[model samples]
Target chain A: EPEVTQTPSHQVTQMGQEVILRCVPISNHLYFYWYRQILGQKVEFLVSFYNNEISEKSEIFDDQFSVERPDGSNFTLKIRSTKLEDSAMYFCASSEEVGRNQPQHFGDGTRLSIL
Target chain B: GESVGLHLPTLSVQEGDNSIINCAYSNSASDYFIWYKQESGKGPQFIIDIRSNMDKRQGQRVTVLLNKTVKHLSLQIAATQPGDSAVYFCAENRLTGNQFYFGTGTSLTVIP
Candidate 1:
């Protein structure tokens, strides 16, 4: 099955550093999303991108967070000036199309640890 | 106001037995629901999904039942195995938005 792929299974950075997480969605997918899971907590939606624009975002997706589809296949999440609270597991997901019934597939996730 | 949560935090079942996990949603507009499984170090894996139009949908060894009136969803795994031991989460998506709100996740342990 075609799956979403994320780079750097784990990353460590300083609190004030900038970090960019990369994802390669399924070739045929049209909608992509970014989510985060704090340790032992529920998954939180960060943003969703479609047609090269941000379709939706959450309050957690503030000025520090931004998403980009620089090319046809690569989707990226950039966090400028990461805070200690930013330490969490970031997951990239995608679906073939936008619909109420389409299921979003997920990547293994990147464990971002800010010191 | 799109927060999905599970009723139980953890459940234990014997190998070869059936397991049922339940989730609840407060959003009445949520029209799509999905169940996902996650191991200790992996992302949420899609297991099955049900739309508001359907009350029940079945997949390979799993079945999903949705009750829109009560805003409740349940995932049933038949003949559960050790591999089925993981955290299960239910996500709800509404017609008003494309974002999916995930549940708190229920951890299942299969005793082999």
Candidate 2:
């Protein structure tokens, strides 16, 4: 089956450094999302993207974070300056269409570790 | 903000037995619910989903029951196997344009 794919299974960066996490959603998917899970915590929604723009974002998606569909198949999340608290497993998900009932398929996730 | 939470933190069952995981959502407006399974070191994998309009939906070896009136959901896994050991999470979506709120998750251990 087609699946969402993320790059760099693991990443380690300095607290003040920048990091870019990339994802390639299923080819036919129309809606994309970024979510994070701190160790032993719930999965938190960061942002949702549709039509090449941000459709919605949560409070956790602050100024330090940005998402882009830089190419036809690539969706990326950029953290300007990583913080220790930013360490978490970042997941990229996508759905074929927008509907409350539609299920979103997720990637394996990129484990971000900030020192 | 609305939150989705699991009633139990963990559950242990023997192989070939059945497992039931429960979840509660504070948002009455939540119109969609999904159950996901996550193995160690992996991401959440979609298992099954139920819409608010329906009370139940079933997949291969899993069944999902939703009680919108009580704002509760449950996932039932039949003939559980050792491979079924993982963390299961229930997520609720209040709107089509909104993001889903995930539950604390229940760790399921299927013993052999």
Candidate 3:
């Protein structure tokens, strides 16, 4: 089955540095989302993007965080300044459409580690 | 804030036995619920989902039961196997929105 794919399975960056996580959602999907999971915690929603604009974001997605669909296939999340607390497994998901019947499919995830 | 949560942190079942995982949500507006399974080092994989309008839905060897009055959801796995051991999470969402609120998780260990 077609699936969402994320790049840089592991990312290590210094605190205060900028980091960008990339994802290629399923080709036919129209809505994309970003979620994070702290070690041993539940998955938390970060942001949702559709039609190249952010639909909604959580408080955890603050000023330092931004998402962009630079092209048709690539969706990226950039943190302007990384912090220790930002370290977690970032997952990308995509759904064929936004509806009760359409469930989001997730990628393996990018493990971000801040030093 | 309203949240989704699991009834237990861990459960153990023998191979060939049936396993049931339960979840509860405080948000009455949440009309859709889904269960996901995550193996070690992997992301949540969609297992099954049910809408508030339905009380039960079944898939291959799996059944989801929803109790709207009590705001409870349960996932039942028949003939559980070793490969079925994983951390399972429940998520709730309103059909009007696109975001999903996830529950902590339940660790399932299948004893060989």
Candidate 4:
């Protein structure tokens, strides 16, 4: 089964520095999403991307966050300034299309650690 | 904003036994629901899903029961195995949007 893939299984960055997380969604998927999970907390939605644009975003996805589909296969999330609270496991998910019953498949996730 | 939540934080059961996980959703407008499993350090994996029009749906070793009257959902696992140990979450989708709201989750431990 084809699955979503993310680069840099783990990322460590200094506070105030910029960080970019990369994801390669399934080749045929049309909708992509990003979600984060704090150490022992519930997974939270960050943003959803479709047609090279953002469809929806949560409050956590503030001014510091931006998502870009620079190319056909790569989707990237850039954080302008990192903070301690930003440390968490970031997961990339993709669905064939946005519909009532379509399921979203997730990647293993990239653990981001801020120092 | 409504939320989906689990009733139990942790559950331990012996291998080969049946396990049941319950969830409560407060969104009356939600028409779709899904259950996912996540292992440590990994992302949520899709398990099974149910639509509000149906009262129950069954998969390989899992069954999802929906009680729309009480806004309750339950997942039943038959012949649970050690590999089934993980955190399970219930998520609901609103009829007007594509976003899914996830519940806190329930950790299941299968005793060997």
**Which one wins on DockQ?**
1
Least well predicted 10-residue stretch by lDDT in candidate 2 chain A: A97-106
Per-candidate iRMS values, in order, are 1.1, 1.2, 1.3, 1.2
DockQ of 1: 0.73
Q: Which tens-of-lDDT digit does each residue in A1-115 have in candidate 3?
A: 9999999999999999999999999999999999999998889999999988999899999999999999889999999999999999999999998654569999999999999
Sorted into a CAPRI-style docking class, model 2 comes out as: medium
What tens digits encode model 2's per-residue C-alpha lDDT throughout B36-111? 9999989899999888889999999999989888888989899999999999999988864568889999999988
Candidate 3 Cα misplacement greater than 4 A, ranges: B1-7
Where is the poorest 10-residue window by lDDT in model 1 chain A?
A95-104
Q: Give the alpha-carbon lDDT of every model.
A: 0.90, 0.91, 0.91, 0.89
- Summarize candidate 3's per-residue lDDT along B1-112 as a digit string, tens digits: 0123465688998899999888987688888889999999888999999988899999999999999899999899999999999999989996557889999899999999
Instruction: State residue A14's C-alpha deviation in candidate 3, in Å.
Output: 0.4
Error of 1 at A83 (Å): 0.4
lDDT of 4 by residue, A1-115 (tens): 8989998899999999999999999999999999998988888889988888999899999999999999999999999999999999999999997665678889999999999
lDDT tens digits, residue span B8-105, model 1: 58899889889888898879989899999999888899999898989999999999999888899989999999999999999998876877889898
Tens-digit per-residue lDDT, A51-94, candidate 2: 98999999999999999998999999999999999999999999
Superposed model 1: Cα runs more than 4 Å off: B1-7
